[model samples]
Target chain A: MKSNNSFRYFLIFAGAGIYQWAFWHETPGLNISIFTAFIVPTLLFLYPESVKKVPFWLVLTGLLSASLAIVVHASLFATIMYVISIILFVGFAHWSQTKSPVFAIPSSIANLVLTPYTFFAFKNYVATNNKKSSVFLKWVKLFVLPVVILIVFFTIFYNASDKFAEYSDKVLFPIQDFIYNLFGNITFASIFFFVHGILLITWILIRNKNTNLSDAEKNQTVNITRNKVRRKRHFQFLGLKREYLSAFILLVLINLLVLAANIVDIVFIWFGFEFKEGMNLKQFVHEGTYLLILSILLSMGILLYIFRKNQNFYSKGKILKVLSFAWIFQNLILAISVGVRNYHYMEYYGLAYKRVGVCIFLILVFFGLITFFIKIMQKKSSYFLLKFNSWAMYLLLIISSLFSWDTIITKYNIKHCKELDYEFLVHMSTKALPFVDINKLSTDLSYKNPWIINSNYNYDYFYVFSMRNYYVKQVFNFLYDWETDKFLSWSYYDKLAYQNFMSNPELVKSYKIYKDYRIKKNQIENGNKNSVQNRTPALHSDESR
Target chain B: METKIQFKTELLHYILMNPVRSEQSGRVVFSEQFAIILKIITS
Candidate 1:
C-alpha cells in the first residue's frame, strides 16, 4: 500500500507534465484529442480498477467526442462534450455500483463538486503520517506551498498586466533566472499549466469516501412509494384524494386553455398561413419562440408539481394522467408550431444564429416533453427525468458539433434569400468567409435596395455596398490564416474553406475592383461632405493575401 | 418517346418585381425568398 502511494504520487506528477505538453499555449485542436487519449492510459495506471471498468458505451462516447476535437478543432460544443464524457467516463466507472452503472448522473456531479475541496489530499497525507516531522519536512511545508502559490499568482499577474509585468520582472528577475536555470527551458505559460495540472490530477485521483454521491444515488428508487391503506382522518391533508381533486381541476382548466391555443395554431399557422407585406415574420418567430419556451418550461414544472408522490399513485389518477398526457401532447404541437414559424421566417428572411439556435432548443424541448410523458406513466421521480434528459442533452451537443453551423447559415442565406443580411454575414465565423460568394452581391434581385423605399434607415445602404472591399479584405485574411495555421490548429472546416477559396479566387478579387469603383463613384457623388470616406484606406489585397 | 423540361418563371418574376420591406431595424431586409421558398409540410 505504501509503495502504491509512492507510485500514485509519481503518476500524478507525470500526468501534470503530460498535461502541460499537450495544452501549452494552444487553443483546442489535435492537442485535446492527444491529451484525452493519453489520459485513458495514465488514469488506468493510477486507477486500474476504475479505468478498466469504464463501460464500453461511455468509452465510445469519450472517443467520439475526442474525435470531433481532432476533426474540427473543438468548437464550444465539442470541447464541452469531450470534457464531460471523460470526467463521467472515469467518475462513473470508479464510483458507481454494478447495478447502477447509470450512476453517471450523481458521480459526474460529485466529481465536479467534490474534487476541488480535495486539492490538499497530499498535504493531509503528509501531515497525518508524519507525527514527528523531520527538520527538512518542516522547512518544506512552511515555504513550498506559499512559494508555489506565489509563483502561480506572479505568472498570471505578469501575463494579465503589462505595467505590473515590467516592474515585477525587474524585481523578480534573479529568482526567475534561477528557476530558468533549474528548469533548463520553460515559459510562464508552461509554469502556469504545470502548477494547475498538479491540482487537477489531485482533484481527479483523490477519493473522498465520506462525501461520495453515488452511494446515495444508488439507493434512490425511481418509483415513488404507495400506501395500500389510507391515513387517519386527522392526516387527510396529506392524503391523495384532496391532492387528486385539485390537480384534476387544474389540469382540466389548463388543458382547455392550451387546446384552444393549439387549435388556433393548427388552423392558421399550421394549415394555411401567408407572409403578407406588413406582417412581422421576425416578430412572429423571435418573440413567439421566447414566449413559447417559457410557457413550455412552466408546463413541465406544473406537471411535475401536480403528479408529486401520492398523487401519482392516486386510485382515481386515470383522469389526471389523461389530462397530463393531453397537456404534453399540446406542448409538443406548440413546439412544432414554433419550429414551423421559424421555418417560414428562415424561408423568407434566411438563416441567422438565433434561428439556428431555436432549432437546437426545439430538439431539446422535444426530448423534455417525451421524458415528462415517461415520468408520469412510470411514477418516476424528477431525478429520472433529469438523468435521462441530461444524457440526451449531452448527446445532442455532440451531434450539433458535427456540423459547421456558421458556414451552413452563410450558404443557405446567400442562396435562399435575395437581399443578403450583411449583419449576419459580417459577424460570421472565419470558416464562413469562403462560403460568402462575393459574386452574389450582384444577385440582389431588386437591383435597387428595398430599404431605399422605406427610407427609415440607420447606416446608408450604399455605404454598406462600398464596404465590399472590407469584406474582401476579411476573406483574404481568412484564406491567408488557413494557409499559415499549423496542423495543430487545423480543422476539417479549414480544409473545406481552403478548397472553396481556391475554387473562387478570381471571383472574390472582382468584388474588390467593383467595390473600389463604387467607393470612388460614391465619394464623387458626396463631393465635399464625405471627404474622410473619399480617402480610401489603402486596401492592398495582395498584402492581406 | 419524347420528354420536355419546363421551368416556371413565376418565382423569377416575383423576385424581379416585389421585395418585402424588413420589419425590425436590426433584422434582414425581407426579399423575394418567400416566393422562392418551396415549403413542404410533414406531420
Candidate 2:
C-alpha cells in the first residue's frame, strides 16, 4: 500500500515536471505539448485498479493529430486539431477514471467545463491527506515565516544605512538582473498552459479515488429509480387514437412545407433557373441555410415528442412511424437544398471559412436526420440518439481538422473561379503564401475595380495594401535574417514556405517588382493631389514604370 | 448517533443555503466564498 502511494506521488511529480519543461519554454509547438499532455495524464491517473480504463489507441490517435496540426501552417486547421487533441486528451482521461460508458460526451464536457472546481477539489483532498502532504505543508509554513521576517528586516536595514545600501546594491542589482532575465520572457500564454496542464493532470490523478460504483451498477440503480417513477406517473395524457391523429396531422403539414421549399430550391438553385427579381445569391443563401437547419432540429424534437415510449405502444404506431420516416426524408431534402444554396453562394463569392463550416454543418445535419430515422425504427430513446449524434460530430470535427483549408480555398479560387479577390487573398495569413500563384495574380488584375486601383484610391484601402506588402517583406526578411535562431518561430510550415520563396530567385524578383510597383504608384499618387480629380491615365501607366 | 447525523445534515444544508460572513463585519456576506466555507466546514 505504501509503495503504491509512493508510485502515485512519483507519477504526479514527474508529470508536473514534464509539463513545465515542455510548455514553459518559448516556441513550444503544438505537437510535443499535446503529446506530453496526453501521456502525462495517462501515466498519473490510469492504472489497472483505477475505475476508469482508457484504451491506448485513443491517446495515440490524439498525438498523431497533434503532429499533423504542427506540420500544417494554416492557423484554422492547426487550431481545430489542437482543440480536438485537447478534447480527446481530457475525454479519455475522464472516461478512464470514471469507468463510465464509452464515448460519454457529457463526461468529457463536465471534465472540461468543471476544470476549475476539479482543481480546487483535488487541492482540498491533497491538503487533507496527512500521511503524504502534511510534511510538505509543515515545510512550506516553516519556510514562509523566516522569509517574511528576512524581507522586513532587509527593508529596514537598507533604509537605515546609506553605505550598507550602496554595497548591497552591487550584489542585489546583478541578482535582480539575472532574475529578470530568467523570468521576463515568460508570457501569459506559457503560464496559462503550465497552470492548466498541472491542474488537469492533478485533477485526473485524484478524481476517481472516491468512486465506489462501476458504471453498470450505477445504471442499474438509475433503472430501478426510473421504474418506480414509471409506476407512479401514468404517461397516458391523451388517448392513443387522438395522439396518433395529432401526430399524423403535424407530420403531414411539416412534410408538405418541406416539400414545397425543396421544390423551389430544386427549380431556382439546383436547375439554374433565374431567380425572382431582387433575389440575389447572397440574400437567398444567407436567409435559408440557417433557418433550414433550425427546422430540421425542430423536426427532430417533434419526432422525439410524438414517438416517446408510451406513445409508441399504440396499435396505429406503425402509421406514425411511417409518417415520421417521411418527415425525416423531407428534412433530409431540405438539408441538401441548404447545401446547394451554400454552394451557389461560394460559386458567386469565393470560398471562405464560414462557407466551409456551413457545408460541414449540413453534413452533420444529414447524419442527424438519419439517426432520427434509426431511433424511430429501433424504438431507441432520445438519449441514444443524442449520444450517437455527439460522437458523429466529434469524429467529423477531428477529420475536418486534418486538412489545411486555406491552401484548399486559395488553390480552388485561383484555378477554378473566374474572379479572384486579391484583397481577400492578401489579407489571409502566411499559410496561404505557398499556394498563391503570382503569375496568375499578375494577369488577373483586370477584375479589380478601376476606381479603387486609380491614383485617388481610398486611404484605408491603400493602408491595408501597404501593410500586406510590409508583412510579405517581413516574412522574406525573417527567412534570410541569419542572426536569429531558426527554431524561435514555432511554425515549421511557415519556415518551409519562406525558405522555398527565398530559394527561387525568379519568384523572388517577381514579388519584389510587384511590391515596388505598388509602393511607387502610391508615392506618385500621394505626391500629386490634383491628379485625384482628373482620374489620370498617367497614374495607370505607372504599372509599366 | 441518529440525532448527530441529522444535525450534521441540517448544518450542511444551512451552510450551503446561507452566505459566508467576513470576519471583520458579520453583516458583510460573500456569496462567492463557498470554497472557503467548504474548507472550514470540512476541517
Candidate 3:
C-alpha cells in the first residue's frame, strides 16, 4: 500500500471488480468486460510506468460507448464491423509489445470476445493472403488423422454393421440415449474442460510462485540491509505438502479422463456410430464406477498387506488407517451413485458397442496403471523396468481379450438382424429432430428471420407438421403456448409471406412491377398527385419479370 | 433541463427491456431492474 505502484494495483483491482459486476447483467457483454479485465489488469500488472497506456483504456471506453449508441442501429452487421476495428487495433498493439508476453493474456481475451467474428476474419485472411493460405495446408494432417482412424476402425468392424442396427433397435436403447443426452452432453464436457484448464493454470502459477519465493530468499541471504518486512512474512507461504501433491495427482487423473472422452468421440466417428439416448450418462457412470471400484479394492488389499507387515499395532497409525479407509469409501460411493443412475433396473440394461465409453475407460485404466507405477517407484525407491514391462503386458492382455470378445458378440448379433429396418431409421430421424411447438420454433426462428415478417404463413407452420417439430415438443416443453399455433402454408402463400419469394431474382422483379402498379392504382383512387411520380415504371413487364 | 431530458431518454432506452409495475406509481426498484447499473459500473 505504501509503494507508488500500489495505487495502480488498487485501481486495477477496483476496475476488475466493477467490470465483473457490470458483466453479470449483460448476456453477451460479459465477453467485453472480460476483455477489459485482461487489458487493464495486464497493463498495470506488467508496466506500471506509462501514460500512453491510458489511451488504451480510452479506446476500450469509446468502443463500449459506441455500442450503446448503435444498439438501435438497423444494420447490426455494420456495427459489428466497426467494433471489430477497436478490438483489432488494441489487440495488434498488445501483440507488438517486445518484452514478456503479458500481451498474450489480451490475445486470449480477444479470442474469447471476438471468437465468431475472428473465425470469419481468419478464414478471410487465409482466403485473401497468399502467404497465409499455404500455412493451412501444413496442418491439414491433424484433420486427416481422424479420417485415417475411422478407416481403420471401419475395416476392423466390417462384419458388425448389422449388429449395430440390432443393438440400436432395442427398446432399452432410448434409455441409453437418455443417459448420453444427460451425461455425455457438450455442456458437461465444456464445464469439465473449463475446470481442467483452471486447475492446470493454478498448478503452473503455484510452481512459479515457489520458484520466485526461493529465489527471493536466496537474494535475501546475499543482501544484508533488506529486512524490509522480515519476521512478519516468514510463514505467509508454506512449502508444498502431501495434500497438494494428492490434489495435483487428482488433477492429472481428471485431465486423463477428459482426454479419454475425446478419444471415445473419435472411435464413435470411426465406427459410424452414435450413443443411444439416455445411455451416455449410464455409459459414463458405468465406466467410471467399475474402475473406481477396482481401484478401491486393489488399494484396500495393498493397505491390508501394509498393516500386516507393520503388525506392531502402534505402527498401524490413525492417519494412515483413516486415509486408506476413506479412499475406499469414496470410491464405493462413486460406484454406487453412478451404477444406480446408469444401470439400476435390470429391464433397462442391454449390451451395446459404446466405443467412446470404452475409450474413456481405457484412459482411466491407463491412469490407474500410471498410479501403480508411481506407487512401485515410491516403495522400491528405484526405477524398475520389469515393473513397467509387466504392467504393459497385463494391460495388453486385458484390452485385446475384452475387445475381441465384444467384437465377436457384436458381429453375431448384427449378422442375425441383417436386413435394414426402415422404421428404425425413421425413428432415429424423428428422435434427432424431436417435437416442435410452433411458438417455440418461431422464437428460435426470430433471430435468423431478419425480415421481421410473421404472416399467415407462420414459421411455426413448417415445424408443427414436421417430424422435427414432434421431436422438439417432446423434449422442450419449457416454452409457453407450445401446444397451440398449429398452421400450414400453401406454396403460393408461403412464397409471398415467407422470404422465399425474395430469393429469386425473377420473382423479385415481378413483385416490384406488381407492387408499383398496385401503388399507382391506390394513389389514383385516392386522387393523390404522387400517382404521377410512380409512372416511370416498366412500360411492359416481361413474362419472366 | 435539456441535459435531464436527454439523460431521461437515454435511460428510457436502456431500461426499456425491463418492465416496471406501472408508468406512474411508487417505485420499489429492484437492484437488477436495469442493465444500465452494470453498464455504468463496468464502464
Clashes of each: 0, 3, 31
* Pairs of colliding residues, candidate 2: A52-A96, A52-A97, A53-A96
DockQ for candidate 2, please give it: 0.01
* Superposed model 1: Cα runs more than 4 Å off: A1-3, A51-56, A59-63, A98-119, A123-190, A227-238, A439-485, A499-545, B1-43
lDDT of 1 by residue, A130-187 (tens): 4333544567689999999999998899899999988987888999787764464455
CA lDDT, every prediction?
0.62, 0.56, 0.34
Instruction: Candidate 3: list runs displaced more than 4 Å.
Output: A1-9, A12-14, A26-358, A378-545, B1-43
lDDT for A227 in candidate 3 is 23
The digit string of per-residue lDDT tens for model 2 on A1-545 reads: 12234445555566665666554432324545454555654644453343334433444365466556665553555555565555555445444543223443345555555556655554443324346655655777889989999999999999999998999999999999888655554668767876777665554454432332235323532111112233444565666588888888888887788788888888877887554657677767777787888888888888888977666567667877888888888888888888888887787777877789898898898889888888778667665675567667666776776676666777787777787766566445555665664433322212343334453532313332232332343344334331132243356566666776767765455444333333333334344332222221211101110
| Winning model by TM-score | 1
In order of appearance, the predictions have TM-scores of 0.66, 0.64, 0.23
Top-down DockQ ranking: 1, 3, 2
**Docking band of candidate 3:** incorrect
Candidate 3: give its CA RMSD in angstroms. Answer: 29.0
lDDT of 3 by residue, A1-545 (tens): 11232332234344444443333212222244344445544444433432255334433444544343233221222234334434433442333331111232245343444443432243332213344445545677668999999978865665578775565458557888887643443455455544443332222111111111222222322111212343466455432244334434553454455346435543543344444666665555556557655654565455434433122133224444444444443443443343333333211333233322443344454444444334332332111222243334333432332222222323333344344221222122111211211222221222221111233322322322322222222222111111111121011111222343245454344334333333433343334533322232111101110
The true-versus-predicted C-alpha distance at residue A111 of model 3, in Å, is 29
State in Å the error of residue A64, model 2.
Answer: 3.2
Candidate number achieving the greatest lDDT relative to the actual structure = 1
Q: For candidate 2, what's the RMSD?
A: 20.4
